[model samples]
Target: MLVNPHICPAETTVILHICPVEMLVNPPTALAEMSVSPLICPVKTSVSRLIALAEMSVTRHIWPVETLATRWSTVTPVQQRRSSTLAPVQQRRRSTLAPVQQRRRSTLAPVQQRHRSTFSPVQQRRRSALAPVHQRPCSTLAPVQQRC
Candidate 1:
């Protein structure tokens, strides 16, 4: 990959054309606080006409379709939007949470659900069955079961 010496003299560079913060901001800004300050990160790759892009910054930000889908994939959305101008300027919790979510599971969901085992009538079986496993069974397990 050809690195641009003009942008920054580094192999990887992040050009932060940050908007003037409307909200009072300090370091370590949380997602909740970001609602006031619409921080968007727009990426430009392989664009030949760099000069025109400056004038067209308004149109680029006016459409979030470019970065919305990508941001959705990574962040645990606080309140997901179908349409928004500043799509990249979302309240991102974390994009890396995807792996953690996948690692967790879809297992225990139906487990805790009320079990009206074929034996019982609908009303009578409203009670959840004796849990096959406790909530966070690993924590409760004896030392032997917890072995690495």
Candidate 2:
């Protein structure tokens, strides 16, 4: 799967499916075929063009990062504003969550360590007891007979 961090997440899945082989062979023919295919819903002409461009870049073996970045930059101002607004909210969420996460980890670490320390010896003893059974001895007797 092609994952370009520059591209918005919503578009990434769709864009990833635009294969180089399809574009290199013939974008128009490929798009036309895809349009008529029962599986593919009719996409807007602009979206189809973008998919074609993305696929074309794959054929040229160009990294899609720059292309996606440029394309994203050309997105309407409304989308730009929406993204900009989301940035601070995301930052605020991170800033708020960081200390809580750190506190949780700090509290959990000691409990986990204690639990591990208490259980480890018992677990080791159980494993050691089982190990001999797992490593069957070269004996004529069956396991039950050997144990008995």
RMSD to the hidden true structure, all candidates: 28.4, 22.9
lDDT: which candidate is best?
Answer: 2
List candidate 1 stretches off by more than 4 Å.
1-95, 110-148
Give the best candidate by TM-score: 2
TM-score of 2: 0.36
Worst 10 residues of 1 by lDDT: 14-23
Clash pairs for candidate 2: none
Model 1 TM-score relative to the real fold: 0.15
